[model samples]
Target: MNYIQGQTALDEEEKEGLLISTITTRAELDEFEQLNIESAIEWTLHKKLKKEQLLSESFVKKLHQKMYGNIWKWAGKFRKSEKNIGVNYYLISTTLKILLEDCLFWIDNKVYEPEVIAIRLKHRLVSIHCFPNGNGRHSRLMADLNRIDPLIAFAQS
Candidate 1:
């Protein structure tokens, strides 16, 4: 579980279920994961999304699965044990439900500008750290899928 200088370390729970054992170095794992995530992004880019669809728990789980399924067997599944980050393992579902409801409310009421909404959603999701790995990337992709233009401008700023 030793992390490369700047890379995040995979905990026992995170790496225990990996499908690809040949990946020994952090760079190799990162490269494979990035490729998998890029493919998921391309797949998501073509889909037409509805507000309800965007707010569903299923959508989030499926998105995570799509982003990391090639690299890990536990992709899309919530962590079963505590990690160095994230909510307690048991709270992930309820916490995510609350976050999604809040997001739905934000969208429904237009409580924030689109850029703000996307940024907040991305930040909250990453804070939740629902998955064993790739929460940051998954959340970023989720934000991008919501409103790419706004997120793009928001990021550049």
Candidate 2:
């Protein structure tokens, strides 16, 4: 959040953390509910996603909404709005889909490592910069869904 003016003596202010925190980057936290979920899983890198619970599209959408409804709250919850930047809109929804598909595919095939999945998910989530706010927190929560983390409890609704 540090800013330096670009003139006599300013212009090299690198944003400390992507979001509002020092350790967490923008890709880290996407949802408030994620912290809770992560905590339940623990520090294990092999944390597994809920395959049964996520089978239903409706269920996933609901979980998504519950996890990140706040982002929509900044504008509209579901439907798109003309007033928003195209990139933001795309990032929010597209990234969500990416998250679901990637995790499912990676886990189902059992070819990918959990750490790899989590790392990729976390990095991309932040890169997308979805949601005007809270994108960072949500990304972290989503990425660590199966892991045992204190933040999981906090991220869950």
Candidate 3:
């Protein structure tokens, strides 16, 4: 696998989760994942999800599932083992709960502007690294969904 600089190399155990066994190189894997992610983005655009729904734990997992379910068996599930980054595997659920709650509180109280809230949520979500793979992409999409209304409004103006 010809990995580019800074790309996280999946361990053998993690690689075993790939649904496409024929994928042999980083480029092939990335292309497949990108296609899956594009479909997930389109799905989000069509769904009329409420703000609360977007911020919930279930939604997070569901979105991740949507993003990578086609190519990876562990798409929506939390990692079972510790990785180089992110909180311990045992802390994932509790830490994610707190982050979600905090995001809701920030929104309800107008603790920050929409863009700031999105950035904070994105940063925290990536830091948490909830899923086995696609954490960065998932977090970006989550942030975009979280602030979708404002984004649309800005585009229209």
Best by TM-score: 3
Candidate 3 or 2, higher lDDT: 3
Q: What lDDT is reached at residue 115 by model 3?
A: 77
Runs of candidate 1 with Cα error greater than 4 angstroms are: 4-8, 149-157
Model 3 regions lying over 4 Å from their true place:
150-157
As a TM-score, model 3 comes out at 0.91
Ranking by lDDT: 3, 1, 2
- Could you estimate the TM-score for every candidate? 0.88, 0.44, 0.91
Tens-digit lDDT track for model 1 on 1-157? 4574544456776677878989887789889999999899888877766767867889999999999999899898887777677789899999999998887777667677677878998999888888877888899988877666433334344
Q: Which residue pairs clash within candidate 1?
A: none
lDDT of 1: 0.80
The lDDT per prediction is 0.80, 0.44, 0.83
Q: After superposition, how far is residue 27 of candidate 3 from its true place, in Å?
A: 0.8
Q: lDDT tens digits, residues 1-157, model 3?
A: 6556655556778788889989988789889999999999999878886567878889999999999998988889998887777899889999999998987787777777777888999999989888777898999999888776553234334
What is the lDDT for 65 in model 2? 50
Poorest 10 consecutive residues by lDDT, candidate 3: 148-157
List, in order, the clash count of every candidate structure. 0, 32, 0
Better of 1 and 2 by lDDT: 1
Q: What is the lDDT of residue 61 in candidate 2?
A: 44
